[model samples]
Target: MYASFFGLSQDPFSIAPDPRYLFMSERHREALAHLLYGLGGGGGFVLLTGEIGTGKTTVCRCFLEQIPADCNVAYIFNPKLTVGELLQSVCDEFGIPHGHNGPGEETAKDCIDPLNAFLLRTHAAGQHNVLIIDEAQNLSADVLEQLRLLTNLETNERKLLQIILIGQPELRTLLARPELEQLAQRVIARFHLDALSLAETEHYIAHRLAIGGRHGALPFDRAALQLVHRMTHGVPRRINLLCGRALLGAYATGQSVVDRKIVAKAGTEVFGDLPAARSAGHPKAVAAGLGLVAGVALLAGLGWAMGVKLPWTGASPTAASSAAGPHIAAARPAASQASAALAATATAAATDHFADLFTTLPRAEDAAWRALAADWKATPDAAADPCEALPAQGLQCFRSTRTSLALIRQLDRPGLLTLTDAQGRPAYALLRGLDARNATLLVNGQPRAVPLATLALYWRGEYATLWRTPPLDDRLKGEKARAAATAQWVSQQLATLPGVATPASGAAAGDSPRERIYRFQLAQGLVPDGQAGPITLMLLNRATGVAEPQLQK
Candidate 1:
């Protein structure tokens, strides 16, 4: 109900385990890497445990999507079962004909025999089998032992079945039991996922909002965002609950922006008795009155009298210009001098360019996307979202907040810029061209070159762009195997860079590939996490001259 009011396409904070909404924070990437590492560990238990609602299941779902076609998977979400019942469920999942009445009517042998036969047959046919048990902490000791025995089915090489146990932190405690030592010993890989850090929480919120089609600036202010992390303790589920309720409250109060007071009130409603921030004690009536006056002043000062009509609202101009006149007079120089050097160079040429841009600005966000598509020389389906459609042509959409022009220059790619217009409304322009002095932006299907200083005045640096991923090799499906291959690839690419010594006995000589990647990331002004995630890979592709589009000079 509040989605449209907030300029969102859908509810951003739904609790559903949607992989598309997953935020790949550093910890989440590490968690996913561990799961992938287990896939190539030659058939053993891969354990992933986290607190409830920490996103283990969501990560697993993403892992499932990347599973190789040659692997067969059986997923069991409910593990509170007897050995016979579990075997039966496994049989049901794999569509094996395990006949015998219910649990009491069958010996464990009856189910194991057919499963073993199936595994051996599939193994002989060069197929791998994976069994994933969620909520495995509830598994009876006997059932877990039975699962361990299933791993015993083997050829001369590796075990026939690979089992992954995912559950809450209690699962780790359960595995630490004396009797379960053998099972714990067989776990070739393990990772414990922790709650999001404060920075990650902020990114997580922005990620969901972007995915949910939020246009313009965020509704919550920076202080409120920080407060959200504090109130939710960085747990995703709690964040979702509080943020969803906060948006609803803002809508009910007829407010566009969600300030600290709104968030505190929402937190109180969601988690009883949480005190509001000290500065939030002002009565709502006075705040609303001030907000109304501020609103009129802002709109009246928009300079829309330049003949650009309000497209979204179609409301007539308010006659509050008398009150707004002085405010606009006082703010112009502050807005214009966002950069002293750029402001100094902002001559009539740049002013004329901006005027034409405002008069012909495209209102819908999709127009910016279409402009970006044209940069790649690709056509997207008219009825489909461009981001979703372009993937078929091997492109993926990446969005980031709190970004800077230097980072954009380093990436060296054409992208969309979310700019605030004279009306203080969110406006998107296709950034097809860039240079030190001016940026060439595509607005309303026309190109305009505006001085960078003038550009800085309207843009707060929210950017969305597309990157092309190179075709994958056969090693794409297996986690550890792929990591090794990727490391080798990274080494080869680094060798081609100027002044870099040849990678000599790197991993064997303590200068590991991860360390090299970290150094390379630091040099490239990236996060330096030592993981070759999408951004890192994209830079590699660019440096290596992969046949992708580059930003216009």
Candidate 2:
């Protein structure tokens, strides 16, 4: 309904992951860079981990789009399989023949020999092979060990086979285990993706709107954008869902412009809890009475004047002038004053109405803020620390340049958490509640959970917020200890491996795919420049021991 009114051609807010609508926030860009780096590195392992709905899969798809033509990639979306099943899946993915009748060991050899031979042939021919396992947290320890063995098929310089593990936080935890130390050591590069910031969230909304054909100012306003960010916590998927619903609500109401009122109504329906409507008072009653009077007078004048004919030319010029003069003069000031007074009254009433509404509505108690202030009052030096008395659970707190406050969970689970300015009443509430299981947080209408390891890895990053009152330096040290322990285990395991040979010095130094490509070029005596054509990647893979990926026919 709003489309025609606003002169728009289509719905601007949509939740679908349209490539055209992909907005590369800073974190998303970094995640994409890490993925591309891993793919281009050509050997060892690359890991990508993040929270659910942080656009990990989207970043992977974007990386896939940029891969070199000669690069063969086998993407495994589902990794929940036994060790034997995984090998068979890899064989199936590569179109390697597997006979029905054979001993397990014999069958394994048949698969491995052909795969190894193929890798050598591909290396000689100059091609890059990559295996990407999404939801890798599901892979069992045995399956992971089997994957480590696949990297064993290599020449003197590097191993033949590159593996990319993409999953939620659990995947990182799995790798961190002492048993999987070798696999962890093999991770040449790893990156944990994060949710977008408030600024990025606004950009994401606009980007999606533009992609959806919103050429001009659209329904969402700045306040709405802030509400979207606060409620969604800068999660793209949740933002999409809320925005989509708000747009639909605006359309349903035949609203040409989407304001806070429309947004609030949409939010209440989508999430819950409608902001209290302002109570009408004497001023509004008086205005209504005046409006009623004006209507009656206008209608009465029209009714009395109907069918009363007067000849314009026959009337005396002085009489006509006199008659029109009084009417025009009388109507001017009365009409102007009535219009001005009515507008002034309406404005005042509206202001009062909203002010009263905000004052009455439930708000996130500023207990944390009060506590910080009290501490400062008691001892100015101690005010620097804000988390002093904050509760542990369901309390999301952040410290920025301007404000430090705890975000209490008004509605836990998978739903929007709306926050309005202290002065502004809620104009919209478009949150959806979801249920979660062990590894998944249900979003919108779907269940998605990242691996526990992925969450653990992400929690180690600078952006991860901690609820406890541990010193920042101490937390940082703990994170370093965990990472070091994991890394050491991996190194020892890879070193003791029976067949695999360690990479030469300067193997995993590059920060990006282009950098890795440059390294590859240098190793092969090609152009030192970072441009990775098919030949460069192929040579790089051979040097690094990454097997050539082949498609199953």
lDDT of 2 at 250: 37
Per-prediction TM-score to the true structure, in the order listed: 0.58, 0.51
| CA RMSD per model (angstroms) | 13.1, 21.8
Score each candidate by Cα lDDT.
0.72, 0.52
C-alpha-based local distance difference test score of model 1: 0.72
Error at 28, model 1, angstroms: 2.1
Residue 7 in candidate 1, Cα distance off native in Å: 1.6
| Model 1 CA deviation exceeding 4 Å by range | 100-104, 275-553
Candidate 2 lDDT, tens digit per residue, 1-553? Answer: 2233333466555556677666666566556666666654558888999887889888888878988787777788889887777877787776667654554454566667777887787777777778899999899999999899898888885666788899999999999999999988888778888888876676576556655555334345556666666666777877776676666543332222344443444444454442321111243433443333244334433533684322211233233223434542332244433443454355346445434433333343232233323322322223334344333221223332211011111111111123343443332111222211012322223333422222221121111121211212224357677555534433333334332233445554424434544444433434334664433433333344443221111
Identify the leading candidate in terms of TM-score: 1
